[model samples]
Target: MSSKRMATIMGVTYGIAAIMPFFVGDIRFIMHILIMCLIWAVVASCWDLIMGFAGIFSFGQVAFFVIGAYTSAILSVQWNVPSVVAILLAGVFTAGMGVIVGLPCLKLAGPYVALVTFGVHMTLMPVLRGEIGIALGSGGSQGILTIPPVNILGYTFSSANQIPTFYFTLFLSVVCTVIILAVIKSYWGTAFLALKDSEEFAMSLGVSAFKYKLMVFALTSFLTGVMGAFYGHYIGMLSTRMLELDLFCTLMVMLVVGGIGRFPGAILGAFITVTANELLAPLGAYRAVTLGALVVLLVLLLPNGVMGLWLKRSDAEA
Candidate 1:
């Protein structure tokens, strides 16, 4: 099958999966897991835009995620802004910060860039922990509680009815996927690939590496920030734990396990990692060991990820 056809099938399959929980009946816990998967999928996709396509190794993309979540949480809980409005504002705020961070760091290359971005992510934890006078309404280690739930057109998503929130997250996921896909398939995406493959060559061909890099940073950060806002509202609380290194590591693993630069890799990796984590939860302390082993095996064996395996099969058949 052609790549386009495969992508279409994958998209349709994911859409169906998104709504499958509603038909499964009374398995709210599973539905919750699916919802989380969709959220991470969105985040991983955004991360791919910068790291995979743009060739920027950003270890701290989660900083934008945290910024977005806290921005929305503070706006809704402290300023009494509407949930939807706060989310939008959060996207804008995070994108602006992305520019601030990218401007300085994008000029650097290799491990230095990664280190700077990682530093930025670490530095935000203290601020979010209220080291800065209740910054973003966070109560230090206590965190923020009673975050307003997402309300849309008189319908509020609460613990009793998780279905609405699931659908809401699914809708946002679709939107994010479409937007990122569109950007990736555009001329700008070509520039990103060229920059990634060979920066000097791309510049020789009239592509501006700095410009595209900055754009990707701001754009991906906005999308991630929007998802973070949804997450804050959906969970009905916020804490520095949400911005932990473990979560960042999980996002990286998803990208690696899903096939890095491949578009579907983000979603596939997110599903696999999240599902695997949940399933291994019953394994007690050994869960981490098992999960780490699985990841190591996949990396060593598959290299490009599960999506890469599929592509390899397709090529062999063709």
Candidate 2:
């Protein structure tokens, strides 16, 4: 099929898959997977906006993710604010943090920026644990529990009702992804791609590389924070563990295996990785081994990842 037609087909298939849990006997299990995947899809796609288009390799994306969840949770619990308003405030606060971090690190690039961000993520973990953060921030290492479920539009969601949460998450993920994709295809996206190729060159062309880089950083932060809030509400808890280095590594692997720089690759990577993890659950000790082996094989044999290989072959034919 032509690429456009293929994409339409895939989109429909995914939409159906998102709602399948409600009809299937294992509604809870399926909903868990779909909702988790949708959340990762949002955060990972947001990460791609910087890593793929802006060429900013930030290891601390999770810092924003955790901030969103913890911030919303604390605000709701401590201030007795509604969850809806808390979520919005979480995004705003996280985006501000992104800009604060971006300002100094904006002049840095590549591995250097990556290292700095990694440090930032690490530093936040302890604070969230309440050793430095508000005892309310992370509940003093016990983490936030009893977080209010998302309630809006006359709809109420709790942990027991998984299907509704899954659909809600899926809708938000789709919306965020579409917005990011639209930006990438617009003048701003062109400028971002140019900056990715060469910051000096993009600036030479009067692209205001600095301004666009900051914009991408803040936008990414907002999206990532929103996903984090969804995760916190769905899981009914928020902890530093949710934003650990291992999780970031998993995200990196997914992005790499799915093909960095391709939007669909982010979603594809999340699905494959999540599915593989779930399927391998029965193998116990062998699960980690098998996953590592598969990743190694995929990297060694298909270095550009699945989507990258397809694009390369298509280019060769044309």
For every model shown, the clashing-pair count is: 1, 0
Candidate 2 Cα lDDT to native? 0.78
Across residues 1-318, which tens digit of lDDT does each residue of candidate 2 receive? 134532553386367767587577265776787777778877887887888877888877888899889888888888877888888888888999888888877888689999888888988877777566755556866788778888897687756877777777878888887777777777888898898888888899999977998898899999898778767776778767866666887788778777677666777777778878889999999987888899999988866666655565653232
Q: Scored by CA lDDT, what does every candidate get?
A: 0.84, 0.78
Q: Which stretches of candidate 2 lie over 4 Å from their true place?
A: 1-13, 22-25, 312-318
**What is the alpha-carbon RMSD of candidate 2 to the true structure?**
2.5
Residue-wise C-alpha lDDT for candidate 1, range 11-100, written one tens digit per residue: 875877766875874798888888899899999989988888788888767889989998998899889999999999999999998988
Best by lDDT: 1
For residue 290, give model 1's deviation from the true position in Å: 0.4
TM-score (all chains, Cα) for each model: 0.94, 0.92
